[model samples]
Target chain A: MAQLFWDDVEIGMEIPPYKKAVTLMELNRYAGANEEYVLIHMDRDYSQKVARLPDVIVMGNLKYAYLSNMMINWIGEEGTLKRLSAQYRGMDIPGPALSTEPTMICKGKVTNKYIQDGDHCIECEVWTETNEGQVTTPGSAIAILPARS
Target chain B: MAQESLITDEVRAAIGVETVSPPELVEMKAIKDYARAINWPDPPNPLHVDEEYAKKTRFGGIIAPWCFYTTLGRSAPRQRVPLPPARVGMNGGNDYEYFLPIRPGDMITTTSKIVDIVEREGRAGKLIITTSERTFTNQNGEVVGIAHGTGLSQY
Candidate 1:
């Protein structure tokens, strides 16, 4: 994989749009893998009865993992993923295309560029939006990019 | 120290020490299983790549799927014997800071330290929030990533 060179990146650059469709099977697998059997992540009946939700919801960690991979894939290895901060804003319930009223959207906007301790880097304001356009996981990250020679 | 208190020296000591586990190797099949299970679109394509496609795509190789850390984070749960009044707590939520992208062929180990503790009063009862920092290192001992997550407990 070609490391993302700083020379190729543009200020205010926008990464390619990426989408991930979460499903029941995926939620089950995640829960099973983590041994997180909380009713909210599965068992629609329990979630509705205990949590008072319309249906079982996806785990917040699932979204965090999905968005992190997408950003890493976009940046490549030349750059390092410095940080990711997110909020568990909405519940992802199972359905057809656009299950929840708002589809989860992850976006990145370049905020700053500079070098620290001899390494060139860029700061980005990253966020996730619901299909309804509600910002859910609002976060930021700093990546070390190869210096343009 | 009162049995009901969550801030005992023993608990504090457990939080202070850092723990590093042996590296675990994750193969393409295990990763693909995660994708298939999550039903994440663009799965097999992102798993492996061809020359022609590699030219067009920015990501040159099979990118590691996200949440790989969740697996690494599960290396081992802190053993806690349930006392009559103080039972082990449930995970409330995690606030993670991802430092680097985990790639294929990379052997990652999680090194963690409990950073902080906060006690609070909730409608249900008292709760404790424990924050931990888990740094992922590559085979070369290079710190590739770091994650700080919070574990919550209520009794």
Candidate 2:
């Protein structure tokens, strides 16, 4: 991975989109890793019958992780992730109900750049959208990148 | 007739009450599992799973992914605002600030508190939004990260 320097960033620059096709097994794995065993996320029967949801829903925290990964991949090892925030505005279902192809698209746009307390800071507006173009999670992040100097 | 307010006096009093969790040791397996969970179909980032490669990077050793803290302190009891029962509850969102890298073998302690609770009339009828804050500290007493979470309950 190449080191991303503050000099390389410009306002309006967009981070390459990170895409994934969410599955039931993937959601189960996330439940094991995070210990979030909420029935709405694991058991389709419980999710649909008990919870009255359409199907097992993806964990909001997992979506948060996706957004973080997008920024981490963009910043590289030298850059530091300072802050990340998101609001879960919509719900996403995994597997066949959605589509066979990758549906979750994670994206970010650099919104601002400046020096703050000796740190070269870059702020970005980040979000995840379904293939249908509905923004499920919307958020922002701040990262510090090394300076060329 | 007006709907009854969910923010009772008892619920208001529960705000700012804090729960402190016992320290738990971070493990390499947990980190790797988390990395794999999020990066399914595609390989996880080497910085999170590849120890040999991470040794040469600035982190010196493999570090957990940015949101790994969400997995910590799960067994411990949490403080919840005393709101009236509602039909359904769901995760609203989260805000996280990372101050340090969490590495394997590090001990993490978490303190959580409900900061605010508000009621609103929604399309469904009534909604309760609970905002909470959690602080994560390492064994060295350094604050590694802080998370602000919002949970919504609808009636």
Candidate 3:
């Protein structure tokens, strides 16, 4: 991946979208990795009967991580992720069997570009939208990118 | 008659109460696992998984992803405010500010506290929003990151 320089960025530029399909196995792996064993995220019966959900749902932390991944990919090794924020507004279910199989699309647009405390900083509006056209997770991020000089 | 507020005196008193966890040693394997889980199907970033590649970078060594702090010291007990029963509780959101990258073997200590509680009317009925702030510091006493988490309960 080519390095992204602050000099090359524009205020309205949109970063490439990152896409992923949330699956049950992927959720299980995340559960182990994060050590979050919430039954509502892993057990179908528990999610339906106990949580009163149609099915097991994706972890909000995982969606946050996805947004982080997207930022990391955009910033590259030289750039640093300074801040990130996300709000879990809607529930997203995983499926091939469920009513709708949603693909998680992580998208971002550069909102501002400036130098702060000697670092070239870029602020962006980030969010995750499902194929069903729902913005389940909306957020923002700030990153420090290297300058061409 | 006026409806009673969910922010009881006990709940109000719990604000600013802190819970500090013992220092936790960061492991390379846990970092790799977390990166893999996030990257699944696709290979994880070399900065997180490949030591050879990372050693050549400015970080000087493999560094965990910025959000990796969330997994640290999970089993430690946290202070919680007493509240009325609600039909559902969920993670409302998270806000993070990063100052440094987490590297292998860094002794990370976390201190968390409930900062605020607010009540609002929702479509369901009453909604209680609790905000907690956690600070992560390294062994060298350098602050690595701070996170603010919001949890919501609906009655």
Give lDDT tens digits, candidate 1, residues A1-149: 56677767777988664465666766777776555677677677777785556787767777676666656777775566666665555556655543432246678777788878887878777776666676666666677777659
Give the higher-lDDT candidate: 1 or 3: 3
| CAPRI class of candidate 3 | high
Give candidate 3's error at residue A12 in angstroms: 0.8
DockQ of each: 0.32, 0.85, 0.80
Score each candidate by Cα lDDT: 0.63, 0.89, 0.88
How many residue pairs clash per model? 5, 0, 0
**Model 3 steric clash pairs:** none
Clashing pairs in 1: A26-B37, A81-B99, A102-A131, A102-A132, A103-A131
Per-prediction TM-score, chain A only?
0.84, 0.94, 0.93
Deviation from native of the Cα of residue B91 in model 2, angstroms: 1.0
Top candidate, metric TM-score: 2
Model 2 C-alpha lDDT per residue in residues A1-149, reported as the tens digit of each score: 68789999999999989887888877888989988888888888988887778888889999999999899989988899999999999998886643458868999999999999999999999999988989999999999999998
Weakest 10 consecutive residues of candidate 1 chain A by summed lDDT: A94-103
The prediction achieving the highest lDDT against the true structure is 2
B57-132 per-residue lDDT for model 2 (tens digits): 8889899998997887664576666666777789999999999999999999988888999988988678889998
Q: What is the TM-score of each candidate against the true structure?
A: 0.71, 0.95, 0.94
Q: Report the lDDT tens digits of candidate 1 across residue range B33-99.
A: 6655443444533443333553455556565554556667456445342222423343434445554
